[model samples]
Target: MARAAGLSRTTVSYVLNGDFRRIPEHTRQRVLAAADSLGYKPSAAARLLRGARSRLVLMVSPGLESARDTIGGDIVTRLGQLLAEADLHLVWQLGLPSVGRAATDLAPAVVLVAPTEEEAAFADLRRRFAVPVLPAFPGLGGFLAASARAQVDHLAGLGHQRLAFVRPAAPAFDLTAEFRQQAVERRASELGLPAPVILRVDDSRESAVAVLRSLRTRTDPVTSPVTAVCAYNDQVAFALLAAADDLGLAVPAEMSVIGVDGDPLGEWTTPTLTSVRSDTAAFVSDLTSQVVALARGETTTVEARLPEQARVVERSSTVGPAR
Candidate 1:
């Protein structure tokens, strides 16, 4: 840039850094034009080392496998736009294994992590970077609990006294599964309903079929046969729907099903699925504000005021059980 602008390196540096009080206006314009022509962009690492704020925000998540089909992708897209408007770049680190390396390389102003991530990882990021490292949103546990309760409430409202909780068999989803299952159990107990029959299911349709059959045939004098299911996610619900179809069970009449995640695929199923959709706009907006504030070094410890409940998207899969 200095050579192209026909100026000293120091002169170019001052102009690029916006220290224009001493330098003439023409010199600053020349340097900027030269930089633009050369496509020269400032390095975030360089800015950070110089004790200046880097225009980088690092976002780390468990994985991107389901991002394209899930709300996770939408949240990331909106978050990037918001950050860009604030002159900050959102850099994603897909998995935890690479977070330390990515943060070191990017020199981000702040780090945001998925709520399901371990606390040790959060601490490591803060200790290594000396920057703010926080969950993408606060009250994640509360949100999960609320969503789970909403599922139970919807089924119970339809006179479903016997409910089953379908959890993912994958170990990767253990944290969220535990939270939602506990919430379902607690809500059922509070409503004077029988405890939810809990079961773990994989992605296989056969697994879902076997699980559903067991729920139907299991002899329990204390509680009635499972009439409704609260699945951990839409995928599980879809599996169960297929199982029900194979068994020739009339959905919402013989067995009602509700799921979390509000997956769009639900609409195309044999019976459209009822789901709890997490309204993430407010949470994303709040997160953007915190990222901007932290990047500007305004303050730390911004309280996350997330939504208390997730909205239920009612569909054909849930209804009053047959008399």
Candidate 2:
């Protein structure tokens, strides 16, 4: 580069490092142009050798297929853009055990865990890599809980006093489903309503039909028949919708339903689903800012600063209880 630009090695180095304030503008431009023509790029390994942090950010998550289907791609794109603006690179790795090798190999400036994973699970990674390991977004549990509360609030506002909580029977969703169900139960109690009946159903229409039939024919005095339902997610809600159609139950009349995760498919469903939408853009922006700050060695509180409530997208699937 120095030979091509007709400059000394020290002068070329100064220009590349942006320390050319004292050098002539023409000389700096010459070095930059030469480097550009040569297709030169800084080496992360070289930077580390020079006592500078590598410009790589490692993101780790479980190997869940649903991760990409639910806001994962959006997060990667938006967060990668933000990191690029700051001259950092983002590498997303699926699986927890693999992150140990990634941390050693990549030597990322910071490590980010998927929100679905517990931060405590990665505590050893932080100590081993001596890098910041944090949740990609803070307060994800709280955000989910708030979403569940929003469903209850929406149904309660529509005069659906008795409600049911429909959770997916999948073991993968057990932890998250528990969190959402607890929120629904708490919110209902707060609104002076009876606790929602909890029903676990699989993706199969048969599972949903059996649960619905049981709810409709309940003679137990402890809990009245529920007129509305708060589904774990759009998929669960779809199962219920299909079951309702199969049983000839009129939606939003015989039974109302609300869901979380505001999936786009909700729009195409019969009697389009009402759902609580997570602000993915805001979440990605906030998470990017946090990662950048941490990479810069800035101290940030662990507490989440995001909005406590999620927005409800109203659709045709919900309404007041029938008289």
Candidate 3:
């Protein structure tokens, strides 16, 4: 194989074993093609026996149970798929102290998907374990900071003077929700729009409907009825839409609703949901690439930042307020 690729045995071994940080891309491709032609498959067990680090990628998160179908879930699911292609395995764990100890035992390259505030605790994990501790979502603080700014800008651009920032009572995810609320308020003020009304509703159809009903048919402050709402994510937005249906409120015509997480189900809603589409595919690609590189002991640079701009997919749910 080395002679076929016109490379030394060590170079071929490095390429086949995924240790190509210093190898030129062209040379790596030549070695990979040679291996493919020779039908070569590296032995993972052999590497383990030789005391090489385990090909395990541990995904740690706090709300993985309830976060299914959200952006965070998409990241974990997609990352697993990406890592598998690199001959790596993913083991998900809840961000608990016991799991932390288990992680040390496993000695896997770690991807922390926990809350932003908890990041301080993991500061020394990389040094302690001598394994990479890459971030999957760059923490909720970064995501919400970008997502919330996009939401407020989009609504204000659509001439929504009075807006409401709707959040769910998700205790595990409250830190993110609070930061998102702050982002909305800050952006709204910067755009010269009125301060947004912050509303926390239970994650239920009834609670959402009650809030939508009050916003739809209230009279004490007739001058400023909330014409638009920015939900924390698509699931919360779906609840608001269901509530609108129950109250017979005309979506977008009477109230405009926008959400984050470009969930496909958003399109099936009565008035297709307008939403901030997080670049999950791009995010997962960046994250898994870094984890795989780290696991292979390759020094490579990968950005943990979200996309420079948040893309809001316009659908029927968001439009100019009715005159």
TM per candidate comes to: 0.83, 0.82, 0.80
- Clash count per candidate: 0, 0, 0
Q: Which model scores highest in TM-score?
A: 1
- Residue 81's lDDT within candidate 2 is 97
**Poorest stretch of ten by lDDT in candidate 3:** 109-118
RMSD of each: 4.6, 4.2, 3.9
Off by over 4 Å in 3: 1-49, 110-118, 124-130, 217-223
What TM-score does prediction 2 earn? Answer: 0.82
The whole-model lDDT of each prediction reads 0.81, 0.80, 0.78
Give the Cα error of residue 160 in candidate 1, in Å.
0.6
Which candidate tops lDDT?
1
Residue pairs with backbone atoms closer than 3 Å in model 1 (clashes): none
Residue pairs in clash, model 2: none
Model 1 residue 43 CA deviation in Å: 4.5
